[model samples]
Target: MKRFFAKKVITALLFTLILFTFSFLNWKVAYPDLKVSALSYWTDNEQNKWEQLSTLIANVSNTMSDKVFEKYTYIETYGYIQELLGKNEINNFEVIKATDGTLHYTYFTSGANDVSKLVERMKRLNQAASEVGSKVIYVMTPDKYITGVTKFERGMPYNYANETADNFLEELADEEIDTIDFRDLMKEDDQYKPESFYKTDHHWKIETAFWAFTKFVDVLEEKYGFEFPNEELYANLDNYNQITYKDSYIGSMGRKEGKLYSKVEDFTFIYPKFDTNFYFYAQSGSQEIKTEGRFEKSVTFTSLLSGDGDVYDATNDKYFTYMDGNPAFAEVNNFNEPNGAKVLFIKDSLMVPVASFFSLGCSKVYMIDPRYYYGNIEKVISDYKFDYIFVSYTPQNLTEEFFPFYESNLPGRWWMHDCPFINWNGVL
Candidate 1:
């Protein structure tokens, strides 16, 4: 019995030595510059020696751990077990499988509370826009899960998103705010097939956006009496250049779960067939760059096809191919509709594909993503003299910590320029 115990201790010591040696060699090869230096602990004469040594040890330990886990065999086994048990949530994303073997990501809600602050902010914005004769229209876009919930198994526990949106919309209506709820439109539209949203992505497909845009146009025409063109363009499938890539795309959610649990999905990119010339202006920091070109001739050209090289490449986000991802601020001047009205379209990533389509009805469309755009939103509305102020965002965005109107400054702080609205002193 004593011999057996002695043998086990020796074996454990041997294993520990081997692991330490392997980790050291790997770290030395990977990070040759991470050497012990006499001055490293005394850089600028204020650095603490103990703190530097502790940081160095922690970094090396983390690197070794990462290397070991990169090829760990148990990770795949653990993920498989989790999936089998229907416990496939990763971080804040819940991976729910549809009956058709499609994967959809449902983000956990951040709780619904008093959006009174947000409502009050919107009311102030409406009053200011009303003074300038600009109609403020709030369009609440639906999440993929909300519209595609029928595909999911009954009694899933993530209804907080729907509840939150409903509460906010109800509050907005009670406050006499003009809101166009696309959730109702999506529910009524027969075209909202299971394929309306991406199987692996949280965002709805381009076709879905087109359908929602049509409904929004209808609301504009009915309430504000605005005549919008290209009404039939979206209705006809022949008007779009559809490029399909089968079993080639994996969205943000898929990337999070890895290929083990999340299956690859097909991507169908739909580009407008009509000829539209677009002059784009993007503001970044203190510099503004302007580019004048056609839709097919610019960065949007990539939207016509998947990423360059093999279709199976998983590096590029295929959805970002449309409208060049999310820019801080962009102004699209559609020469095709020079006589159309000028509008300010504020939205999130859900509105990326649909943003340029607005130019078909409006001459100049200022697309501002409040999450990234730190400029004065109210000033932009006043300066542009926008005939319409359209706020389009998904329901999940309502629960976002960075939801636009919730900010005390209406559009949040301006990191790039000084926000004049902050110092308006009750001046409309």
Candidate 2:
């Protein structure tokens, strides 16, 4: 027994020696992605411990590397937040002095991207609509930053392209383009400051969305010569600031910041009582025509006719957000429209709630986005004979934001190719 124990101890010591030799001689091979991947393990960058250890293993060493290393660190040596770490990221804003002589500055500053391309797309859509005897109206989506509710990183730039909201509106007026200026609608209500956007995310309050709902009703009455029952769908525009999640969400912007997620209270969408139900479609060949039963009460998987399940393997769970697996070519039918008007909208996800408000306006509504289209839109509008057409986006992302997402998915995927809207839009 003593001899066995002695042999085990001897073997363990020998293995440790071999590992230490490897760690000293060839560390880079063992950990090829050391900087980006191993950052979490290092507590201090200013210290020489990592350098001393790694230099023995690696023949190559960085001179004056501590400057670059310090930039990678978020917090400083004294445990204070370091402003120097993030040079290219964060927002710029004015700071005021408190009575206590303390500096007061907003953590998040408003910002946006491009607007020129969005305007060009709108011009094209309106021209196409006029050719088909259907007029085009646009919806101006407001971003979280524009709304003043998104928490911008501390040191990022807050500039948009030269074309701002005022300039874009002026250009639109100069060109005689018709649009639903939701920004004006938001500013009028004043119930929500621009700060009502999600602090850590890119969505707005449902309460503010109610104002959008009621505005749509008015737009319809004035333009299409029809009255909608607005009182039924929206009772009040109640604001809420209740916290949903208080943590670091690690949003897509690549910033390391803590976020406090909140939601609205007494939220409701006023939809007039339905005398008759309508069928909804998904991308899948199988259809769910209104009469079908057996959906979970809280969950809605509305249409099954135009699009496929996000995950072919998963049931009742899908990856698409905002519009519920919407396709460029899907149709909306109401059977309730007295004039039997057909409407078509070319837009992004901001049109989700806006489209829902349009439930009573048209017997059939078709959706299209040039970014998602596989073919032509003009030919599709001619064939459908739409009474109204709309193309819109928030000023920020209205430009070429989706170009990369669109390009990567082409050849294309089943959702974009066989999907009817993409091919039909270009042909129309």
Candidate 3:
């Protein structure tokens, strides 16, 4: 009875300490946010007050959790404990470590998604492209999990994202829409391995993305009769200065898993050795920013490579060092190669580097991440009349979040051309 009482007392003390620490760390951050959220809801003129309140509450909850003091410390401690326990899964297997020591995000999925709607949406997009004398090609970026490779211990969850991707591409093929599955190409390559991908993130490594870009260039040349000047030199890795930042990157999945469980990655920042000039523009809901210089100065976010702070810092996402994370709309104009080709990419974050490298061979490169873009894509297509349009998404991103404008049947909006942000003149 005495031992039981002692144990209860200890547990109570520990719980009290945690509560006190959290309150001390988060109250300042949460109180103001909550107050602003409440005030916004009060002033909001929207019809759905209840829904707004719910969303505000959810946002507040996330803020509280996120602002918790020493959150990474707690995560690291938990991850360390998980490691001590010899466990392969964490948080009830929301994240599973592969047998090869790579981390994967997964959820329970029974079967492949019915992608007929998505395929139809692509068809509509293709039709729009065809009307402007532009070609649409769906580039399927590979998932981290290679079918026979990327093994998990028995009884781990499988999300069937790969199966959905297979179904999605097959449907597109049946519709006679052109497609490129990087999975097939990667599998055929003798050099592609589990390590070709980030051990902790869904994204492929920079080198892999570069390789994909070269392959894409080949496709454009052989099939579309698209020519890139100085192809041999531009395609060669030796032509670029490859700077590898040792153990500086902690990917998205790694951020969730913590440094203790998912170790940091070595990030390679590659830039061209030859002279080049570019005008880069990015616009999102919150900000509009532009840069002009050579490839490194313009496209690459050099601050990320400064290596001044914690490598495990969540904000120090090295993958985003290229193209500075995905914006709603971004463009790159290569002044030297202005007469080459104009290309547009409807893509997810994976295509950031792909498009960046592609800019070298193109006069202009325009990119849109549909998740954040609220504009009329049909309008953009009609206006630009791009030489080629590539829709690139990782296999796992075969979801509606990546297809925001598909449901709307409205014609190209006249307002889109009038928007100050849209570049009517090819001059930056």
For all predicted structures, in order, the TM-scores are 0.72, 0.53, 0.87
Residue-wise C-alpha lDDT for candidate 2, range 111-224, written one tens digit per residue = 544455656555665665687688666667664443343334445344452236556766677678876677666767774454444332344544455457667767667876
lDDT of 1 by residue, 1-428 (tens): 99999999999999999999877766665463344222332441142345346545665665455444233244445556667777635544466666665666564445655566767777777877887889888888776664344565564336466667788888889888898877787778765456787777778887677666677777778888987877776345588788788776776665555556666777777667877677776653233546667665543636336456533233267776656667767777777778888888778888777766656667777777776555567677666678988877777676444445424544534333443223322211
Residue 382 accuracy (lDDT) in model 3: 81
Query: How many residue pairs collide in each prediction?
Result: 0, 38, 0
Residue pairs in clash, model 3: none
Candidate 2 matches the true fold with a TM-score of 0.53
* Candidate 2 residue-wise lDDT at 35: 52
What are the Cα lDDT values of the candidates?
A: 0.65, 0.43, 0.81
Better of 2 and 3 by lDDT: 3
lDDT of 1: 0.65
**Against the true structure, what is every candidate's RMSD?**
8.2, 14.6, 4.4
| Per-residue lDDT over 1-428 for candidate 3, one digit per residue giving the tens place of the 0 to 100 score | 99999999999999999888868768875676667656655654244566446656776787787666666788899988888887898778888998989988888778877887789888888888899999999999888888877799999988888899999998999999999888888877743578788898888899998998898888778877888987988899889999999888888778775888888879898889988899888876435768899999998888888987666664467777778878878889899886888989999988899889989988999898887564667778888899899998987788887875445456654333222347533354
Q: Report the number of the highest-lDDT candidate.
A: 3
Ranking by TM-score: 3, 1, 2
